[model samples]
Target: MSPEPQATLELQRTLVLVLDLCGTFAFAVSGATAAVRRHLDIFGVLVVSFAASTFGGISRDVLIGATPPAAIEDWRYLAVAIAAGVVTFFWSPLVERLRNPVRLLDAVGLAFFAVAGTEKALAFGLSPLMAALMGMLTGIGGGMARDVLLADVPVVLRADLYAVAALVGAGIVVGGHLLGLPVVATAVAGGLACFALRLLALRRGWRLPVAGGAPPPDGDA
Candidate 1:
């Protein structure tokens, strides 16, 4: 039976919050790790970590009309990011040793952000397309910002499963909404699907194949 709409929504919100926290932690650690590798000062590491963790959610919240945004409103997210960064300074090598696992954690963060962002958009009475777009934005926004700050090309713009996986996950949420699935189940499907797709892509090199077999002519033929 279809769950009460209100109850379903509440559950979805809780799930989203949990996912958001995880994303914050993962991204913060990633940025902090990079800062350590660069021999950045503690202040710089914390700044980058805080930015990495809270920026995406803050941007998502602002777009969805959560005024002041969660990151600015609560302060907990930034505190968490700061704490993680401090710990990372001591354990940076451990993280570097398991770089692949660290990346998988980032993928998990991306999935959670996408799924939760889509659900929030839907709840805010957005059209499905807009909702999905929001999901994509939330999933990739922080990564894009993080890379730009580091002077690297954004991960989402590259030939990777990053944004595409998020898109597919958001699609699941939209489809499930049409099918009248309960919010919890729908969220699980959407988030897990996105996570799986991203991880699988990482495992198998599932990237957008390059277009056009013919090389560009060096000179006019």
Candidate 2:
């Protein structure tokens, strides 16, 4: 490859890595917060944090045939999750003081993971449709795992615009790729789109219509 192309590829990889790590940390914190809320012990908090941070990425990699996922191969992923977990555990009161800190952190993680997962799926030669779905899965998988571990329904299934926001963000990234747009710009735009949608849904109480026109259950996330 030419120097320019190589440099661009390197930069894209770095961007993806940063996004993945950011998502990991954010989700880890959210998971730890939830654990603390449930009165889990420190070890339980760390376990939940690790599961919530890495499970989605691990699933994505396995589906794409990337054996030994980056989360497993890289020590940084583990360190980041542990650090976030410990911080949240020790500072639960501070985290709790933030308005809906779990949801806020979850939104951040969803955005970052959606973009990063879509990019990785595309790089792995998946079709745009499948890549977008992979991105959505990446965004929601951790939350699902966290909720399940806590014995609650997953927020994505019940929350306002959770999965839809992820899909929209993933679609933006895929659209940009198909249109030959810049990778970094598309990533930022997609992440912002997802995060904004999530926050808007939370504030406006927007959600899909429920079966039998019944009221949707209130989301706990």
Candidate 3:
């Protein structure tokens, strides 16, 4: 590869790694918060954190035939999740003080994971459409697992535009990649797309219309 292209590739790799770790941390926080709300013990909190942060990546890797899963192969991923859980555990009161902390953190994680997943799928030679779906799965899988563990309905199933935001973010990355945009540029664009849409939905109560003749339940209900 030419020097410019090589540099871009390196930049993309670095950005993906950074964003992946950040997403892990964000998801860990979300999980830990949920555990705390449920009055789970510290161990349970950490377990939830690890599951929420890594299971999504694990699911993506497994589906793509990446054996052993990066979450289990790489020690850093576990460490990040544990660290996030420990921090959140000790600072539960502070975190609870924040307005809608779990949702906000989950939104950040969702955006980053969507970009990371799409990039990884593309790297694994998947077509753009499949890669986008992988991205959406990576964005929501962990939260689904966390909710299941807690015996609560998954947020992705009920939240306004949750999966839609993930899909849009992945689409942006795929579209940008096809247009020959740098990986870092595409990731930034995609992450911003997901993040902005999530925050906007939260702020303005934006939601997809539900099944006909049945009034949609309130999100906060």
Candidate 1 differs from the real structure by a C-alpha RMSD in angstroms, to one decimal, of 3.7
Better of 1 and 2 by lDDT: 2
Order of candidate numbers by lDDT, starting with the best: 2, 3, 1
Query: What would you estimate as the lDDT of candidate 3?
Result: 0.89
C-alpha lDDT score of every prediction, in listed order: 0.81, 0.90, 0.89
Model 1 weakest 10-residue run by lDDT: 212-221
Task: Report the C-alpha lDDT of model 2 over 9-110, residue by residue, as the tens digit.
Answer: 788789889999999999999889889999999999999999899888889999999989999999999999999999999989988887486678779999
For this target, which candidate reaches the highest lDDT against the unseen true structure?
Answer: 2
Residue 209 C-alpha lDDT in model 3: 76
List per-candidate RMSD values in Å.
3.7, 3.0, 2.8
Instruction: Tell me the tens digit of each residue's lDDT in model 3 across 93-146.
Output: 988887486678778999999999998888788998999999999999999999
**Clash pairs (backbone) in predicted model 1:** none
* Candidate number with greatest TM-score: 2
